[model samples]
Target: MNSNAIKARKKVLVILTQSPYGNALSREAIDYCLAAAAFEQDLTLLFTGDAVLQLINDQNPSTINQKDLTKTLSALPIYGINQFYVDSNALEQYGIDNDFCVPTIKVDVKEISELLVNADTILNF
Candidate 1:
């Protein structure tokens, strides 16, 4: 039997470090995450650096002709990707508080290190 068939599912960590609307990385990350979730894989999403801006609530991307990412991001739990974490330092640097963004746990570098070690696979964008 295949090793994949033997293991139930593997933990996947997705780290987003890109800005939200200027390019396609953010959208691609979401697509990858939803696809992984559809496979019943354990998933964790981490927003670091400028990517955390994607979570900012009450965004009106129509002005820029971009789709509203917050709406899609908030729906992650509905798709079974509930583990969301943000870098506390990034949050502070960006002048964002938890309330300003989609609900997520704020973690420091040490905690991020632990999450990386525990993840079976990591995808960074």
Candidate 2:
């Protein structure tokens, strides 16, 4: 590789569909997002299905001997990862309204489809 070569940044969409704390998938997904952002990748995160639970404020993972994910999520903006989305349908199903630990855009099915179609890469967790 040439030293002067510039790597093209890719539009990466990371979809999280699992519940937090039941296992390590949610944490691993977050780690992947942080790593990709560190490399200057254009990253977007979508929380759908049970993943919507990850966004709720005042999570208490310490009681279960796990690290608090909300704290990690709140630090995403510092890594230039400002594009966070939650499926509107999921929010409705889960009855979540304006209590997210971090700022997130609520995307309808059409917008979610557009996001998937437009991304250069998609990662699901």
Candidate 3:
């Protein structure tokens, strides 16, 4: 690599599709992203399909007797992980409004495609 070349920061786009319960994968993803963010990497998260429901507000997994990951997701901003994104139509399809997601996360279906296209790395879970 040329010393003068602009080394782009590692950019990760994580897609959380599965629901946030029953398994540890959801929380794992959140931790992975936050850890990467701690390294000053460019990290972003997206919610699509049925996963949009995971962003619903006031989530209390205790109802199912499991740990709650919603609060963890909400605390991403404090970890330098603020570039969260969610599909607008997916939210509508799942009947979830914007207030349920990370604060000021840009929501849109088509725009999400553009973001994915521009990402250096993408992991769909």
Candidate 4:
């Protein structure tokens, strides 16, 4: 690799589809996102299915001896990650409305499909 070469930043889309507390998948996904952002990757996070629950406010993971995922999610913008998306159908299925821990764009099935097609890389968890 030449020192003067300009590296192109790949658009990375991380799709989280698991419950935040059940397993380590959600944590690992978040960690991966932060690491990718640290390396100057263009990051986008899409929460669908059970993963949409991660956006709920007033999460108390301490009861289960776990760190609060919402707290960590709030710091995403500081890492230059501003594209947070939630599936509208999932939100409806879960009955979540305006109670998100972080700001997010609600996307429909079509939008989600478009996101998947446009991303340079996809990480599903």
- Pick by TM-score: which candidate is best? 4
The residue pairs found clashing in candidate 1 are: none
TM-score of each: 0.91, 0.92, 0.85, 0.93
- Tens-digit lDDT track of model 2 for 1-46: 8745776667889999988899799989998888988888889899
Model with the higher lDDT, candidate 3 or 4: 4
Q: Give the candidates in order of lDDT, highest first.
A: 4, 2, 1, 3
lDDT of 4 by residue, 35-110 (tens): 8888878889999999999999999999999999998888888888888899999999988868888889999999
Off by over 4 Å in 4: 1-7
State in Å the error of residue 47, model 4.
0.4
Clashing pairs in 3: none
The C-alpha lDDT values of all candidates are 0.86, 0.90, 0.77, 0.91
Q: Is candidate 2 or candidate 3 better by lDDT?
A: 2
Tens-digit lDDT track for model 3 on 6-104? 877767789887778855777788878778777878877887776676777878788888777878788788877777687778777766676675764
Query: Of 2 and 3, which scores higher on TM-score?
Result: 2
Question: CA RMSD for every model?
Answer: 1.9, 2.4, 2.3, 2.0
Give the per-residue Cα lDDT of candidate 1 at 94. Answer: 83
* lDDT measured at residue 125 in model 3 versus the true structure, 0 to 100: 76
